[model samples]
Target: MSGSTAGPEALEPLVRAVLAALADGAARRGGPVPAGPPDALAEHVAGEYAAARGEGALSRLTSLLAYGSADPADPLCAAHLHCPPLAVAVAADLAVSALNPSQDSWDQAPAATTLETLLLGEMAELVGYDERAAGVLTSGGTESNLMGLMLARDRVVGRASGRQVELAGVPRRGPRLRVFTSAAAHFSVQRAAALLGLGEDAVVPVAVDRDLRMDPDALAEALDRCADDGGLPVAVVATAGTTDTGVIDPLRACAELAAEHGAWLHVDAAYGGGALLSDRLAPLLDGLALADSVSLDWHKLGWQPVAAGVFLVRRAETYASLARRAVYLNPPDDEEAGYPSLLGLSLRTTRRADAFSIAVTLRTLGREGLGRLVDACHDLARAGAEAVRSHPRLELCSEPELTAFLFRYLPARGPYDPVRTDRINAALRRGLLREGRAVVGRTELPGTGPGRVRLKLTLLNPHATPADVERLLHAVAEAGRAEEAAEEAAGRHTGETGEETP
Candidate 1:
């Protein structure tokens, strides 16, 4: 109905209602998220849905969604890699949704096919790829990673066994294929390996340095071991921004080592690719141009809506592994007639026109505008790290590399107890969530131990100020104090209950 000629007129009133409902919902359950236990929030949402049995279902459901969302735009909601999208991008996405053009075939999405092709070219250039590069828009980093590794598998394993992997499947007696990546790399690598018929154990985790970046020497040793054991080194995945600390592995070293071992180099820049826009931070990813494939997510730092992920390869020829044909979609005659189709480039059969939003954002802001926003967030993170260091109860764990830092709250009065400290840090984050005061991230430093737990703050909102970050930290400390008091009170209660019947 939204695609009809009268749709615009019909949508005007509905759009206004949705806007009003959004405001009302945000005002009703304020802070970062709805304040209550998880079950209570769920029940309230169920009740709203059940009550909306008539004409106003849209208004009620939209209101409930906005109310329940963990608002990334809120300064206190520095929890994850989620970003607040720009208004221009959101508006562009609305146009795409109304039209509903599927990108799988040429006739289905003529203009969109061209737009996505051009956008991928520009993104490939951003990753230092030449004109021969080819890529496709994806759901996010996870899918992009899968595409990259799938290509690596078919190319490497197929060559070693001299057979088409797509037809015969991985040869049981062929050389073993191994993927080398830093221990800090995203878990998607193992998942991709498993999905490709290479068991999860095929992934070898190389050691990382003190800063949590992959050590190049360790990678070389792993590659050597794999080759010595009659295994083929299929790919080396390097992290441009690790999830917890935002540390980039030594890219130049990893690329060189991968090349020496005849392995594909794939850089997972899902979190740090936004730095490419900033002149100040671009130098950090010096060897990224050497990678055979790269994965980027605009939803993280590019300020676009979700599903704005891209996967690019250095040469178009390498994408042959993903090529496909369907008579109903893109016949040989259609291609010869110059009616290009995007069916061959993607693993998906039906895809949204997600590129439109990213293209609009790029034209609206340009490089310098977005770069300034990136710099602003980075500055806010530096200010936050300083605040954490100066606070008496907060202990700074890692320095900010992009726009995130890790730190944890220490007990104000007691001597350090790793077990108790971990518990306090864990409880404080939930305590803030329960009160609807703040939304902070919690993670553990890599290793096995009680003291590994740490709180994280991923600063993505450029409009957020240093004072806002300071207030967030203060709230965390206060919550930590409250948790400590509760622990002591519970301990006293247990001791009193266990007392002999005097």
Candidate 2:
């Protein structure tokens, strides 16, 4: 029996059941993440699938699987960039999938292609790019960075040489291609270099300032030395929001230096690109438009669903370097028909309609609302930092440059033991995860001596209050004390006295 043979009346109950489940899940928001695996639920679904198959109801299996994933509503789910997407975005995502719009070709997805271009225009305008700018919707910041690097490589080596090298598998004609970025820059830059056949060694890590921002002087020195050493300075990557510290590098200075050295400038603003929405912090990214390319993730700060990232270039013709015509895919005839395929400009083909969700999100939450969200997150971060500073056991590393803070638990009196400190901090983090209290991140900073590892909190959740952050900190301190007590008791039993455990 075909699924089309089923009457609408038969599907009404299943639809209602799915909607009810979604509503129940939505109602359980603002709590700690579920601690246990959802395997039991999955097993139940597997049994149901088997039974449904027996009953010839296999058509419903896809819907069942789509609706049955583990709920992220639980509050303890603050581990990564994953968040419960906005309601508007969720609805738009469903519509996008149902339409199955592919932005690769206009014949397949006419509206989707135009929508993506419009959304790209909006994003470029947000980053101060003019109408002459062109961009493509990417999977995420990583893909965007790779696309920008590929363009940089092609531009630096000349278009014809780049094509010959790619097609004929010949060596690049340019000097040893090199890229520069702060040590704190995201790992994607190095990954991009490697993917472009430049190897990891091609990415030179510039020193960062005390606040974790890229040091302009260090960048200049690195570029000059690279040039003098017969290395082709391909591009300089300036990070807007670093992964750990959320630090925005000196963009204006970096842009000026890139221009002076005739190097391509790519700003990885995947995390901090939303700062452009803010009146206060927008100046921090003042020179973003001056870059040859910029990467922005609407999924990060725009509160859109995942896979919402854009790669914008200042010169529209820069993308011509990536343009290639395939007879079966995008024939020359299609080019004259106003049928522009995003495939030529991006690393992806048959891409999703991620831009629709972003468009819906931006339309629902206007520029003012977006700016307010950014400002609110920054304010909440500051409040959290103040809470950490006021706490007796915690120490704020420095004032937050953006909506992130790095701090560690400080011993109240005794001299700091790096080994003991690491154990206590690790224990505190484990306890928090085990107890399902909070999800604070951990990072290691290489110091002059043995280096020190500390806890980091990324304050992207605008709804998170200072009280919530304080509660998490207090939990960390309590966990630290409990671990110390356990260690002391073990030491007493072992007759080790005050000696630190390895």
Candidate 3:
């Protein structure tokens, strides 16, 4: 076992082998990803699995997995909200993994439970919540959003009907319960509603402005319309950072509306919560403190590994709906005897000690150090946006609010043909993936239009230079040109032979 006295001695050799395999795999790939089609990687994986011979299996498979992965650390791999984890954080994670503590019971993870409690308290203060606030670490934004909506449903909906939602279910004959979020808000809100037995149709999509942020006026109108239709507003979910353009909805305005309507305000700040670290950007989240609950994803912007998500609430008492009394986990006698338990705080039973790594990371790199990293990435995004604006082939969809921007490539020789442009942009992204030249992101704008397709640059790597951004853009333009040329050639051949060629 890793917790045994001889754990370090046993791990040393295995870790060394794994490290060697990683280096070898990265060296062989030599780019963000392996240059080939999806099937090629699949076949390689199959071959490796079939050829695994007893002792060396770990090394062989580790190397194969590393080679196939799209390395987020690579400057060119600016695809999703995925960040390259800091070495310090990863090292801390190793310690947590070795011990393998579960936080469901106090006895199972004594120190871990304490650390998680303290971490959540600090995070609550950072979010402007008072000492009565409480939170729990989550897998990511999806679970966080679900928890927030779930509390909102039980607290608000239950209060209105004067019934306990946990013991009793949602009433069928009550006023229609509704949730309001921006058109650009994360899809998790609707999914959460569905999971809570409120059908997907219960969500009212508030219109967004040109910048893809929720219009406060539109939100007000929607709320009024819901009231007019005798529908109860359960919650208002405001997105702090939209995935496509990174635009934040007007928080203060949304908060005001939610309060006036007696609706619970849940801010999905999974992408923008990192702004709290930076003095320059923290002001953008001015009214975040007013939220009833908030979701933050450290994996996206806190430079932690995957699944480092946090969910917080304004008051601990609001979490009553999730309280539990498992005799083995958190018995009344244990609580009376002053032994703490975290079984009631999570949607999970056997939860890992994820807070340990976050605590280590916070201590190692103080607030100032993490803030600087946030500023660096923000600076990089601004610089990259300027580059996109200056380029003839690139068209900036909007200036970045956080660390991501949206832009599309324009063909060098074509008259403005929206359909053809969309096709070329889509094809170019796939072309880059096949060639392993770059790993850029792709997304469509809010509307269903011919020109909605856009390439994205989510610059999460703070160390990546302006030159790297310029080079990635150039690679995208080159790929776009190749795709355009192929399309034109195909059209010419079809015109000559009167038959479409493959």
TM-score of each model, paired residue for residue: 0.97, 0.87, 0.97
Tens digits of per-residue lDDT, candidate 1, 26-82, equal 888788888988999999999998999776998899889999989999999999999
Better of 2 and 3 by TM-score: 3
lDDT for each of the candidates? Answer: 0.91, 0.77, 0.91
Across residues 134-202, which tens digit of lDDT does each residue of candidate 2 receive? 998888889989988888877765542545444444254556778999988889999988888889999
Candidates in descending lDDT order: 1, 3, 2
lDDT of 2 at 165: 43
Q: After superposition, how far is residue 104 of candidate 3 from its true place, in Å?
A: 0.2
List runs of model 2 lying over 4 Å from the truth.
Answer: 1-16, 22-31, 36-79, 159-165, 168-174, 412-414, 446-449, 492-502
User: Positional deviation of 191 in candidate 3, in angstroms?
Assistant: 1.0
Which wins on TM-score, candidate 1 or candidate 2? 1
